[model samples]
Structure formats: structure tokens, C-alpha cells
Target: MILVTGGTGLVGAHLLYRLASEDREIRAIYRTHSSLHKVLEVFTYYTTTEKAEHLFKKIEWLEADIIDIPQLFLVFPKITEVYHCAALVSFSPRDYRKLRKVNIEGTANVVNLCIDFKVKKLCFVSSIATLGKPISDKKMITEQLNWNPETNHSDYAITKYGAEMEVWRASQEGIKTLIVNPGIIIGPGFWNKASGQLFTRIHHGLNYHFPKVTGFVGVNDVIDAMLKLMNSDNFNDRYILVSENSSFKDVMKYTANSLEKPEPKKDLQKWMIATGWIFQKIGSIFGFKRSITKSDINGLFATSYYDNSKIKSAINFNFTPIEDVIEETGHLFLKDNAK
Candidate 1:
């Protein structure tokens, strides 16, 4: 049997849908009862409501948190393959501690159990944020680039990098492992979370677009890459899974066209970003969520690119174009909102 963490998340949900449809004996861990809805919602995105209900019943849903070692251990008896996707994603400074505890420490615990259980293979989901930033000579970040400690980094990036360390350590301890550094994953489900936030914010009429360029991939492609890597003899390897490097302006324009909303016409100026961060800092004093920060502003304006040729070469896979990904996800968002 296979055990999957974060099985209710955007990527995890899609992974489970694929695994279950393939008639694999799968067990998925979740922290809350409400998260189950997201799993079913994702299945419904690909199939009929009745078929989704049937697929949902096929999964062995277990209530467990990655941080809770005792609870996590109970579900590992017969598990052979492990997919570690559970992580806390937060950009706010206030969430720094929680992100570290859950992302870094929790991943360490998962690594410990994988070793203890003698699991056959472990597939880890890491972010492109863990990759090094390009400098003078280097134009694109790849698996070969080493992270520079002197550079400015987000707390989320810091935690994910730490998590990658745990996975690398596990590989050293003789656990066959595969790590995927995915870009911004655009998909349909849980519209308020992660990349789905882009759809929600755009639908609600966001008017400003950042000029930053970054990597992007659809949710299905990420899952497909993970499975392909796990099934193959490729072990102790890391691949950058990105479909394309695109600017936020084009992404927002495509999104606006798909949603039938007014495209964001205003380019965010440096002064406006500075003022916004200033207000966010002031609001943080009153316990307001800090949506934007100095690190975010810098990242938003930087033109970072990723080299995805490694994964494509390894898996012999082609990624879905960003336009189609945006359009499909946009339709799903509209359909969900209409209900």
C-alpha cells in the first residue's frame, strides 16, 4: 500500500485521484474532516459527480498530522511508497515559526519514519524557491546551482530549503528518493489556497500586475512527473518541474480573458510597492495578516528563470502550455463559484 501526506491539497488531491483510478491500494493522511471535501472536489473536476464519489470511497483516509509522530507512525505499518507533500505555506513574518516547525521539523519526522519503516521509495515535493537565484554568470537556476546564504530569502523559502536537506539526508541513509522542485502550480480546487489564490484575486478584480518572471506548471504535470520518477529506476535525483517561464502580466491577462474580467492594466511601480509594504508593516503591529513584504516585493520584481530540461529529459514528458492551464483552471473556478 502507498501512503500520501497532504492528500487533500491541490497537488496531493490530484495525485490521489490518479492513484485511485489506477486501482492502486492507497492510504491518504489528512488533519481535518473538512479537507476531505477538497479530495472529492478535485476528483469531480476530472470526472462526473457519481464517479468522483466512487473514487473518493476508494481511498483509505486517515486522520494524521506530519508533526505528530505517534499519529503518523500508526499508519505506516504496511506502507511501501511514500509521497511527502505536507507543508505549511505562508508569506507572513508572523507565521515564520509555524512554517519552520511544520515544514522543516515535520519533514524531519517523516524522514525518520521512512527510515524506520524501511520504505521502498519516497517522493518529496519541494518548491523552486529552494533553488539558487541567478547572478552575473548564471542566467537560469537549475539543479546544479547552490543556494547562496548571503542573498535575501523568504521564510517560506528558508523552511523549504531545510526540508530539502532532510530529504537529502534520508537519501544518504540508503532510502531511494526522488525530489521535484515545482514552480507555481496552477490548478482548480480550494480556490483560496496557494496558486488558486491567483484565480480568486483576479476574479475579485485585482488591478495591479507585477513584472516578475517565474516558472509555472499545471497540477497534473507535477503529479505525472512524480509518478514517473517514482516508477522508474531514477533514484537520488532532483528535477526542476516547470512548464514555462512567464511574467505575471501575461499570466494575469490570460486569467482575465478566461474569467471574463477586466485585465490588470496598471504596472506596479517601486514607490507603490514601497508604500504598500509600509502599510503592511504598520498593519502587522495590529495583528493583521501581512500579505506583502520586502522579500516578496523583491521577488515580485525580479526576473528569475528556471531550467526544466532536466525533468523533461528524464521523464520524456511535455508540459501543458500556460495558456491552456490558465483557461482550464479559470473555467473550473467559475464553475465552482457558480454553484
Candidate 2:
């Protein structure tokens, strides 16, 4: 049997569906009141048993927290494999406590469980944010490029790096662990409400324009790569699972073009950043949920890029084109608008 953390998240839910469809016995861990949502609202989490019943049937849900070692150990009796996809994904600083608990403590708990249970394989789903410790070195980052997140600008970077460290430490202790660092994942079921909100905004022309430079990947391709790891006999190591890297302007224009919508007017991002920062400060003072943070605004607008050859060489797989991915998802979001 397989155990999955963050199984109800955007990437996790899609992974769960694929595993169930392949006839694999699976179990997932979740916490309703946990702090993971403090950052991104954990868009895919279900509030009721009835809501969760809407998905695949063969899977089991364990109401456990990643920081709770005793609860984690209780579920490891017959579990042979694990996919640690749970983490606090956010750009806002409001969720520091929850993010640390989930990302740092949660990962440590998984490592301990793996050692105790002698699990066959543990695939950790880390983020690219952890790859750049003291800011990114190259024009793009890959799996081998290791850096510390301590010097990074945001708390999200710090916590994610801490979580990934546990996996790396476990690898040295004979845990047979592998890490997959994915770019922005987009596909059919964007369970993350933030992603869903982005889609909704784009469809309604609320977020009219965007900056240039970003990374993107399709849900199918990400699933394909991860499933390959899940079934590999000796693929016990680290890999950066980034797909085609593109800029925000490029993605935005392509999405608009694909959906038969008018292209947005190009505007100076400096002014927007200044405005966003001002609002962010005000929101914090007023105890309001600031939609975006200054660090996120800076990161998005930064002229950043990454290399994908390491992943291609390791997996010998082809990535879906950015246009195709955008076109496919864009058309679907358009369809949603029609409804």
C-alpha cells in the first residue's frame, strides 16, 4: 500500500486520482484546522465527508498531522511507499507559524516514520524555491544546483528549504528517498483555490496584465514524471521536474490569444510593484488578508529563468509545449466561464 501526504492538494489530488486509476491501494493524511492553509488557504481541502466522497473510492483518508509523530507511526504498519507532497505553499508572511509546523515539523515526522517502518521508497515533492538559497545563481536552476534558503527574501523559501532538508538527511541514512522539485503545476483539477482564483480572474479580465518571466508545467506531465518515480526500481535520488519555462507576459498573452480574448495593454511593472507594496503594508496594519506580498511581486517581476536538461536526461522524457499546455487549460477555463 502507498501513503500520500498533501493528498488533497492541487498536485496531490491529481496524483491520488492517477494512483487509484492504476489500481494501487493508497492512504492520505490531512488536517482540517492545521496551519498549512495560513499561507495559500489549502484550496483543495474538503470540509465535510460528503465533499471528500466526491473523489476516487479505493483511497483511505487519515486524519493526521505531519508534525504528530505518534499519529504518523500509527498509519505505517503496512505502508510500503510514500509521496510527501504536503507543505505550506505561500508568498504571504501571515502563515509563518503554520508553514513552519507543516513544512518543517511535518517533514521530520515523515523521515522518522520511514526509518521506523523501513518503507521501500519515499518520494518527496519539494519546490524550486528551496533550490536558491542565497538567491539563484544561474539564469535558471536545476536539481544539482544546491543552495541555502536561509538568505532568501521570504519565509516561504526558508520553511520549504527546511522541509526538504529532512528528506536529504534521510537519504544519507539509507531511506532510499527521491526528491522532485516541480515548477508551476497547471491542469484539469487545480484544487488550490489560489490557482482557481487566478483562472477565474483571468477569465473575467480582472487581472488584465502580468510581468514577464516565470516557470510552468502541465499536470499530466508532472504526474507522468512522478508516477515514473513511484514505480522505478532504482530511481532513488533527487531530480528537478521542471517543464517548459516561460515568462508571465508570454503566458498571459498566449492564454488570452488561445481563449479568443483581447491582449492586455502592456504597463510598467515598477508602478504596480510600488502600488502593491503600499497596499500590502496598509493591509497588514488593518489586519486584512493582503492578496499579494511585496516579495511575491518582486519575485514575479524579477527577470528569472531556469534550465531543464537535468530532468530530461534523467527521465528521458519530453515536456509538453507551453503553448499547448496553456491552450488546453485556457480553453477549459474559458469553458468554465461559459457555465
Best by lDDT: 1
lDDT of each: 0.87, 0.68
Q: Write one digit per residue (lDDT tens) for candidate 2, span 267-294.
A: 5355655566435322232122556555
True-structure lDDT of candidate 1: 0.87
Q: In candidate 1, which residue pairs get closer than 3 Å at backbone N, Cα or C atoms, i.e. clash?
A: none
The window of 10 residues in a row where model 1 has the poorest summed lDDT is 279-288
TM-score of each: 0.95, 0.83
Model 2, position 5: C-alpha lDDT score: 90
Across residues 30-109, which tens digit of lDDT does each residue of candidate 1 receive? 99998798789899988999999998899998899999999998989998999999998877888999999999999999
Q: How many backbone clashes does every candidate have? A: 0, 4
Candidate 1 at residue 243, lDDT? 94
Model 2, position 334, has a per-residue lDDT of 65
- Candidate 2 regions with alpha-carbon error over 4 angstroms: 32-55, 133-138, 149-151, 277-288, 291-294, 336-339
Score residue 91 of candidate 2 by CA lDDT: 61
